[model samples]
Target: MIKQIDKSNNLPSKISTISSIRMIFSYALLKKKEFILMLLFMGLGITFMMISPQISRRVINILENNDSNTSVNDILLPIGLGVLISLVGAIVLGIGRYFSAIVGTEAQYNIRKSVYNAINRQTFSFFNKAETGDLVARATSDIEMTTPVFNQGITLGFQSIIMMIGVVVGISITFPSISWIILLAVGLFLLAISFCAKRMQIAYVKSRKTFGNLTTVFRENIIGAQVVRIFNSQEKEIKKFRKENADFKDYTIEAIKWSTILRYSGWIMLAVMSSFVLIIGGWQAYVAYQNQDLSFDLGRFIAMLMYISMLGMPINQVNNVVMNFVQANAAMIRVKEVLDAMPEIMEDTNAISAENIRGDVEFRNVNFGYTSTLVLKNINLKVEAGTTIALLGTTGSGKSTLISLLPRFYDVVNGELLIDGVNIKKYKIEELRKQIAVCSQNIFLFNISIADNIRYGRPDASMNEVIQAA
Candidate 1:
């Protein structure tokens, strides 16, 4: 089965150049020698790219001379050289892509693992604030969005920049007269791209955000299918999903419009610039032909045109890199949000660890609340060892919140909670939780054998023990 991530709307947050560069290098997770080699191969591949146009120019010049004295070998020599250069370029570029693929895949794995671990360490309260579906999207789809962008967009994007520089230098050395036209057109293209890109990015962000909402809707519908049927509100749920899906489509179309404008405008500028250069070069060649100077000849004019074409060659690729970069940055930000989360409950370094806990629980003048408005207040309670106690309260009366305190999920805002006359704060968080057994109201069963599920919390328990527990 092939899985495809629809990242059309899965776009980016702001990508600050410096921070993003730093993040890229860090997340790339390549060893120094390997990273250096990847860059070397990409550079060598770009160097070979520069040679092809020059070879074409040389071959054109030789052919244009129209001299009987020029041998067949002379014509074949540059053509042969061009073919050889192409072969070498292919090898180095292939090697570069190979290295990029490995690194990209590895980086994606590390990020996914890190995000999963982060989510696991979070307090139960964290999930109440963050959408479970959005977090899932960040781990899967968002993490996935960065891999290809890194491999194709970032790696090739680097080479594209180098190629652009090569084109500039090649033009300056070979045809300085028309270099300004290429340069001017390029300048305008950049300015125009910059002006429009912000809106494009925003649209992409909206699109991806809607997709996250879509995921949430799907998850809720599936998980709450029983409740939906019980209420006979399946149609309402379907409508909600459709509305979110439509919003995603609309946002994606808006993003496509912006990207299309940027992409096609580049080609248009290249066309206009090529024409302008040709007209000016034609005028110069005509004067030279009339004067019989033979300085600005057909060969040089043809070479100039080839140089212009080469300059425009990488524009499409560079544009693609730019779009990929924006999408990846958006993903990076969401993933970063997960990595940056600090668990509300923390284990204290100096806390004591108990191998065995005596069952004596007391809440002394406890006052607690998720916020300033207290859900629990001024409580005094004790439950002795081997005694069974029940907490009976009306809804919103903090029954669940009070039980949650036993595991140190949230600390009381005031007063002490004691286990065996020892303040719970002094107990190691792990040791404290291990001493208690909790069965949540919303239960989940792992898809495993009954015996396995019975001993999940105590994997060492024998089958006899598992049967007894079950």
Candidate 2:
């Protein structure tokens, strides 16, 4: 039962990045109103932030130009106004973040529900082929990954872009001469970040894949612990688990390495750009001071420096935003894979619902297989109602396969399986299954009372009914 699948072969193939992103965000579209409100609040916050820098310049100008005619109120008023705007900005930003978080959380919740429902609808053959641990990972970790992308990535990323644009416009108006230098720094920063982001994306995908494999290995070991102990193969199982754990560690380290490079490179670029702005702007201010130019002064130079620093903030966020995008993309692909999987058995839309079902069953010229290798050949059988029957065979015989077909666990490839003289396919699958109960050879008693376990199929059954059934 501890079968291994080729994890590499199961890794999601890289699809169009834009298409993946669009599909992921489609879930968020349900909360578009919240998202829009978040943006509006964010815009207000950014507006205040942008205005504060200009107010800072005015306050500096007032202080520097202090004279007999200058009033104390002039400096105090602008400084107070800047502080007030900043406080309001903080409040607005908090509100924006709250709304964004709501949207993100709701989107994640919806996606999780959809995935769970989709998984539940899948036929038994799907579970046979899919790794239980891998499916669990997709439902948990993969869905979690998409949340931050919706919460911080999209909202903060857009805010960063808006802030950058506003800063650029302010800089160009205030210090037209030095604006191109700021643009050049920004362009270089983006180019470097993009290159590193691509590498990080690859690493993140590998890391996610290895994590799924590790989860699968760990789950298999846990479920098969009794088998390992019975065979005294604990050492072998431990070695196998360790190998998968090591692979996961290696992949995680690789992804972290790339992310580190991306972050530090952005920091280095910011440092260089800040130094460039200070030296060049400081030199120009000094020259203007010597020339007694009224156009360029200490206040304007300070404001320009502040604007350059503002540019660095978004540049710094580039790595974080890109990393979130990449991780979300990878997770979305896995989630989509599960959602897109086609169930091997599908109930007909016009399926008949038999009101009263008899226990009689028939198989006519049936053929079945797990894959290409047939496990059951053309055979006909009839089981009369209320008749006691026993199927005895050695291991690998069609006993389990034959009984599994009675419940339509696997549909016949070439013939009909009928129940009460009607093809089982014509019956609603749920209704058909409700009439049959299976007690597998490998009994799995849940951690509950025996009475509760017996009543599991019909919880509404009374205690008397449970006792009678027992």
Candidate 3:
């Protein structure tokens, strides 16, 4: 059995978005050094991008104030420095992306592994209620959705904020009078992003659910193809699939619609920023020039334009980050639902060890059910050591359910099942299971060699034992 993490209380299906994101980060940050290195590289890369613009502004300023005191080297120096820093930004971004990929891949691997372990620990009732296809989608596609946060979502969001602050600060220091206008535009831009985030989250949640349903429908058709062929219902199955496919498409389009809104928000912010600089800031700078004040000049006004142009990249990046994170949060909710289900059988913490066993078994007034209604009721049976008994029953008569009780697959609800005269639940579950084996009615074979398949329940079985069993 996989060792389960007991720290986080398995929250319900309605788990909060921030909590889901926090859970995701817990998985991603497992490799401490890798996460730290990724942040370090990301900070360095964005720093270069930020400084380059400021240096380019200095070049424009030097040329605007050109005089006998200003040399050619003064003109060439800031220009060269700006270009050099831009190149460095590109290189640092490459390294940062490499580390981000490593962290993202590691996170995906860890989450997949943990989710698989959680599934293995689930009881038989879990499979009875869960669609195979829906579970498969959650384990694969939904988990894949969480990965973009590490890849582009986190870095892009951080970069966007840093750049926004840089632009506002640059604008404030250069043209302080109209800095408030720039701040207001940025504030509006953030409000638009926040509005879009709520819409995207709703759309993503619906889309992921519809996709799971669609997957379930498709998997059912494929797995039951023989039944469909026997009943000549292929057309009916195809029609059902098409309906589900349409639902998936509609929900996906809804999500895309919200993403488009976010993209347009960035564009709208850019337009507003440009208008403020070219129109409002222009008037302020003219007044300053008329007053013969050197605090704000035409070159500095041009620098404000440069900052406006630079703000576009972070705006677009923020759009992507919001979309990625909101979608990822929706996916995380689906994944968390699987981990939150309660199993029927929990091994007793104070159970006795099951060592060498006599083959005696007994079921005493046993009443059991997978749900509220009992499938097996008021049953009493006993078998002595070295004796065998056959269970004779019609279909749906609980014969399989009775046999399933011995292995504790589903615990008996209202009676005692004993092995060797001691209550089975009193024995340590692992050791108790190791003492008994049953050949189930449902015949399922794994994709492996025949000998391996024969000895699957006992992987340590020798070749002779496997051959004899086969």
Candidate 4:
């Protein structure tokens, strides 16, 4: 599971656009109540933000137009109102984030559960192809990568857009002519971000591939630790570990490098944009003062500066989300592959349940192979109820392979296998497997009492039966 962290650092590689991330998040956060709560709080916060500039301008104007006729209560009243509004905004923002986290946690839980359940249902053949460590990575690390997408992506993504739009609206309503420069700067910044986002996606994919390879190595070393010790190959294993570790480090550094570039680039863009605003704002302020026109109020100019200043946080947040999505894309792809898989074995139409069984089994003229080479050829066998048949074969002579075939571990390539005269494929897999009891040379033991391990064969078997099996 620790291996997922290495892969997680490579998350941003998969997402192509912010919209893609948003859509993915929406699907993940399926619960309506959680979604509504998150949105409600989010709306409150952004609404407060949009109105904040106007309130600040109001306060400034009150202070500027001081007169004996106007009581001190007039200024104090607006100041108090602004402060109260800000307080409510802060509270709403806090609540919104808290609920967003809850939604994300629940959403990730469902995703992880589904991934684990799907993997568990897969046949032994599936494990033969998929690494145990990779499964762990998907369930743990991959599921975790979706958390931010569920939480921040929806709430923060929307809030950023609202804030940007709200600021633009304020500027347009107040000073129509100067609003063009602000809009233009925002558009240019978005274009640059989009270009960098493309490169981030590419880097993110490479990082995920590297992480998968790294996870494979980690899993192999752990599972085969005893084998390495017995063979006196500790040095070899260590060297291999070092190589994988180095590769993981390199990929992680590459991922972080791109995120860093995006983050800093956004900051620099905002800085440049701010400089432009200052130059233009200062010019406008100067012109209004020289012309003795009340069009450009000092109060409104100061408020505009504050609004643009506040835009910095949302801009940075947007950039951060883009980078996070890049790293998470690998997780999404891995998870999607599992979700989209078509099971090799599926129940036949019109399948019926049997109420009784005598445990008679037959394999007639069955030919089978695993992957490339043939393992069973022209095999014919029958086992009646209560029959004790001894299977004797040389190593790799298909004793284990033949036993495996009985449970349909690997289906026969040709011919028929029947249990109680019905074709094995026609019977439900679980029903067929339940009738057989297998005791191999290698017995699997869970982390439980000896009695429990025996009971695993027959989950509802009596204590006496379990003891007898052991």
Q: Count the backbone clashes (under 3 Å) in each candidate.
A: 2, 0, 0, 9
Candidate 4 residue-wise lDDT at 356: 60
Shift in Å, residue 207, candidate 3? 1.5
lDDT of 4 by residue, 1-470 (tens): 12122334233323333444554665656777877887888888888877777888887887776666887788788778888888998899889888878877777777777777787767767776676666676677776776777778667877787888887888787656678877887887788677776666666665555666678778787878899899999899889878867876776776677677778877887788789888988998889889987756878888878877877988888887777666566567667667555555666786655436677889899887767677889998999978988989888888888788777777888888887898877777777777777778775679998888778766888998987776
Question: How many clashes does the backbone of model 3 have?
Answer: 0
lDDT of 1 by residue, 1-470 (tens): 01122455432323443354457568785545655677789899889878777788777777777888999999998899989988999899889888887777767677788888998898876887777787788788877778767677767787878887888788777788778887898899888678657767777666667777899999999999999999999999999999999998998898788888888988999899988987888888888878997665565567667667776657888778777876776566666767878888877778887558887999999999886888888989999989997988888788989999989998889999999898888899887888889987877789998888889888999999988887
Give the TM-score (vs. native) of candidate 2.
Answer: 0.93
Best model per lDDT: 2
Candidate 4's error at 430, in angstroms? 1.8
lDDT by residue for model 2 (177-259), tens: 87887788778877877787676666666667667777888898799889889999989988987887887788778778878
- TM-score comparison, 1 vs 4, better candidate: 1
- Per-residue lDDT of candidate 3, residues 60-165 (tens digit): 7887776779999988988888888889888988887787788788888988998898898898878887878888988999998987797768767776887788
lDDT of all predictions, in order shown? 0.79, 0.82, 0.81, 0.74
Top TM-score: which candidate number?
Answer: 2
For model 1, how many clashes? 2
User: For every model shown, what is its TM-score relative to the native structure?
Assistant: 0.91, 0.93, 0.92, 0.90
Model 4 regions lying over 4 Å from their true place: 1-23, 291-295
Ranking by TM-score: 2, 3, 1, 4
Evaluate model 1: give its lDDT. Answer: 0.79
| Candidate 3, lDDT over the whole model | 0.81
Tell me the alpha-carbon RMSD of every candidate. 4.3, 2.7, 4.1, 3.7
On a 0 to 1 TM-score scale, where does candidate 1 land against the true structure?
0.91
